[model samples]
Target chain A: MTDATLTRPAFRRGVPPQLIGLGALVAFFLTVELLIQIGVINRFIVPPPSDVIGSFGRVIVEEDVFGRFLLTLSECLIAGVLLTVVGVGGGVLMHRYRLLQQACETWVAAMASAPIVLMYPLFLVIFGRSMWTMIMMGFVAALPPVILKTLEGLSGTRKVLVNVGRSFNLTPSQQFWKILFPAALPTIFVGIRLGLIFALINIVGVEFLINFGGLGQLINELAERYDLPGTYAAICFVILVSILFFMTLEKIERWLRPFD
Target chain B: MLTPANPTTQAAADDAILVVDNIVVRFETPEGPIVAVDDVSLKVKPGEFLSVIGPSGCGKSTLFNVVGGLLSDHQGTVNVAGETISGPHQSIGMVFQEESTFPWRTVTDNVAFPLELTGMPKAQRIERARHFIALVGLDGFENRYPGELSGGMRQRVSLARTLASEPKILLMDEPFAALDEQTRLLLGDKVLQIQQALKQTTLLITHNITEAVQMSDRIVVMTYRPGKVKRIVDIDLPRPRTSEIVGSEAFGRYVAQIWADLREEASRGMRDEEKHTLEHHKGGAS
Candidate 1:
């Protein structure tokens, strides 16, 4: 039986679905480039892929976009770290204490639905127009999803696994670390990813809104100067940042849970 | 052929490894308080392989849970080797009906978990885990995760983990129910071989009559809920029984007799479930 399964076609075994997705993305970029080169689209409004590709070096050297890129990266890192610590810690506490979860669950859901980004004016007044404002906005915007997802992950742990732990006379802490934490990890990672996404959005949006530091500010400046290629290049950098984080997260997740 | 023994009249031997004194479990649902196990009592001797067989919803699993110390809100006391079990005891290891192997852990790690809790040195625990893993016939698959294995293989991993704890009593709640008949029979033989070799005291709760007949020294037949022991059928068949015993004439007789004792209770359980569903539909319509 094992040999028969191993003998199946390479397409069934070796090729990952991600390769197909990558192909689709490349096709999309090529189509856009083709339209721009044939004059089917206006170059002023939508710069060709070639122009954006060419601007990568110029954006880094002439515009000195690396410093701004690092600033945005640091903001995202700070917010991501805060989300993991606070969100996961809060989830563990809520799971441990039923009444606390019940008391705050509805409030957390309401907060998630609320237009939190609009509260930037209030945050700006409180923290001033420094990087603190952006960090705070990113943290707040990212918090709800993290907390909610953490709670869900912890709660969704299979009861049988917990029972097995209990049967072994495992201490509460031992059970949490050995069984509960590992079992809930995949879902918890999902929460972290969602939180990172929200954090990135809020961090960039806040930068653009206040015309502050980071990639968002760089994009805003390039757009104001009517440097379309440079603006698109900056936008590409934003996407690059997102892709970097996503790839890092995927690697970490695989390392932590190799079987899954 | 083995005949059913009277549990109430049977003397509780001094060498009994586990003693349950009239355990009663009740659960309070929105409907009201319902009795799950009512005054169920049994004594399991050291090195004994006992099987508890009953109708569906007969609270066989509930009784197993009580003995495993997973259910503490019961009325009676469960003593293991003369010590009262208040919570999960280290000497009592349980295998659940559902897949209980940690998906995150490799086979060796899953087996080593109980030892890890006791703060056993990593090298020693892994060594101990490997012994039990090999005992369950999973010699080469030590580093593989449970997700990568078949259902039967995973259950074997669970069994190995439980056995690695070196528990005085093993409580298996339909550990083979999820597997196919062939796998179940094969696993049953493996469990019997382990029990015979180690002299392990085991109590297996299963609905399969043939499994009880093929594997157990004594089969405890239970009635519908509130579950009460109907009879304790002692297998007088020759020991060191294997999968081959299933074809024996004596095995067929034992299986037939257990079905006879359980048939009425099974129908009664079905009737009650039908009535409940009818009432539920009527309530919704009204």
Candidate 2:
């Protein structure tokens, strides 16, 4: 404590976290750029960071990357919507029914560890290499964690809180919406973030494998033509898509549970 | 219908607002059936603060749950103002031992929850809830969440919530059990002040000797197992009391007397636990 007080007037002072983060990122890219230019690191396998940044405009204009990003974003949003709706609803159902929970909770946990992308061939046959196939793949890959975590969240509500609800004589629906749902929300958000991670990976992976969809297909073509700079640039757009969903999810969570 | 059950032999029944009549609770274990509470009965006069003090595993919580309508599988009836409770009753409110405040809700919102369930208008509920918040001395904390508040402050929020609901009887199961001694005593003083101001009938279940003696008008001591009322000790202290009374000789005497009554039961409870563990070990050996 005394050390902190003594050093209070030194160079150590408050700084915005985002600024420091941006600085670190810039320093990393500059170091890589210098390394590749100095020939200490080969530029064949990995392009210089400057070239990657320089190719961003070309890829966006020539590849119609924004339109493709929007397509991928919409498909992901649909899959995400389905994952939460179906997964949480399924969890709530299982929570309400002990028999169902006992029967299928293990199966859901098992599915979480299984490679869900293995079933893409069947999804391909059914959806015919369209957006539906990718959507279905993302939706399925992301679902298990949401269901398991929803059940976990609902089950984890304090007995005291539920008793308070009951003592007030709340109806079934009111008990759910007022007490159970709100109490379980933080955990449910955790499930959504985890599920979206799996969903986005599978969605982009399928797009790359089939060469017919969004950012992943762009990445595949750029890699095939030895356009390493453009390939990395396209991967940044994929990261952008991820950041978009995560930021929106965080905003919604903050809005819903302000204190937590 | 409940008025007919009032026996003329018991004068307190005529004025009692809450009555627990012959409640019996049993739980079936793998070994056999264990009776938690055996034909326990009590009554609380209107505007009185009554406490039930006992050792752990004495089924004090079982009786508390029965009274609060959280556990209803017991064989008996809990009546509030001549009305029988089939389940969670509107006239009955509970303050629990665990942290009961919702972390997502602000102080005013948590207090306003019961009112919101009753479909009161948003503005009216907020206004009413603020009154109770102020009553519990948490006025400026109306917008703060449970996570933002201290443990004692959060308990105050729950207390305010129960009070806002306007329940005829408040059932508290060791509400201040989690707080430090100083905070507990201070909060206990506040709770007593609020109870007197509202003329609210309260039933408190706790194992703290001084806590039971400090706030209660009367305390019922329960036995270790198959919990039965061992004695009912009336606190003859003056009214409008505060935490200051704890330093007095009379308060210490009351605490000592209740402790004497509870000491044997607490030891018996510990012995029974030891015996059970020993028996389990023997069975494992076999």
Candidate 3:
């Protein structure tokens, strides 16, 4: 019985949606390239797909885009980590204290829809147009969703599970650790993913606006220099970075919740 | 003010493992304060298997919850082994109707959770959990999470987890209601065997008459909304009961008797539901 129950099927699992999506993306690019080659579409405005693909090597070598890529990656990493810590911590605090939740919940929701990016000038004055300014902007823009998701997850734990904990005479802290936290984990991770997305947008946008550092700055430079294909290649690299972030988040979520 | 048939009931039984005395639970809803359990009382003898069978919304579950310490703000006291319970007591374990097995944890870990709360050593807790897991016949699937298991298997895991706590009294709130009839009966047999072996006092809240007759030493029948204990019927059937025993003539008689008692209350509940639906539709039309 033990062996039969424990052994999963030997065959590999079904194909992932990401693989299918990649297939569709390649097909789309091929169609666009064909249209441009046949002169059915103007190449000046939307560069030929082949030219953009060919410019990847030049973007890496001549443009030295890797350093700028590293800069944007670092900003995103710092912002992402801070957003997670502050958002999850604040969420737990609000959930634990009713008064705090009631007072700040509305503000948090409003902040989520607020035009936080428009306050970049204010942040610039406070932090002096440095990477800190960009990081802080990203952090503020990304925080609300994480806090709200964590609150929802922790509060939404099933009453039956909590009752089970109570019946066993678990202390509040013990109940949180054993029952509430683990159950809330999937939702909390969802918040983190959403926060990372907002952080990535603000980080790249700020870099472009300030003409400071990272892939966003490179894209701005390439566009201004009429290096259209190079601009597209750099933009593609930014998309790759987003994909990597999401893929890593997905792997982490799976590792943390293998059963789910 | 419907009085329980066994009104000569002892408030404090010397051999009683659990005594619920005149528990009245009321909830303040938008409509007003609704009485759920109205002055209901009962006692379970040590190692006795007792079932509370009732019509829908009859407060059998409310009574069960009060006993389980999941609900407070009630009017009366619940004593377990002569001690009053103001809050959740470690000696009392509850199994819920809904699937309550911790999905994030493996079967072994879920069983070992209560043990872990008491700060038991890791190896010893696992060893103890393994005993109950095997008792429920889930030895090999110890490492599998609850999500990977079937509904019946998950409920078995819940049963194992509750039993592993070794509570003096187990309160089961329609724990097998979600399963099919066949699985319910099979699990009922497993429960009877476990209760016989362990001799733990059990209070089961169920709507199934057959289950009440097959597993319980005594059955407490309850009325509809604002629930009151309608009767307490003793099961004179032979013990060492199993699913096979449910087919016996005596078992059928006990089930028939309880069904007869419940038929009126069930009809009333259904009528009330229909009236409410009609009223809601009228309100919508207006």
Please compute the TM-score of chain B alone for each predicted structure, in the order given.
0.96, 0.94, 0.96
Q: Which candidate achieves the best TM-score against the true structure?
A: 3
lDDT of 3: 0.89
What share of the reference contacts survives in each candidate? 0.97, 0.97, 0.97
lDDT of 3 by residue, B154-239 (tens): 99999999998899998999999999999999999999999999997899999999888889988889999889888888787787
Better of 2 and 3 by lDDT: 2
In model 1 chain B, the worst 10-residue window by lDDT is: B2-11
The candidate that wins on lDDT is 2
Residue B38, model 2, lDDT:
85
Please name the candidate that would achieve the greatest DockQ relative to the true structure: 1
Model 1 stretches with alpha carbons more than 4 Å out = A1-22, A34-43, B1-12
Comparing 1 and 2 on DockQ, the stronger one: 1
Error of 3 at A100 (Å): 2.1
Model 3 off-target regions past 4 Å? A1-19, B1-4, B7-13
Error of 3 at A36 (Å): 1.7
What TM-score would you give candidate 3 relative to the actual structure? 0.95
Model 1 TM: 0.94
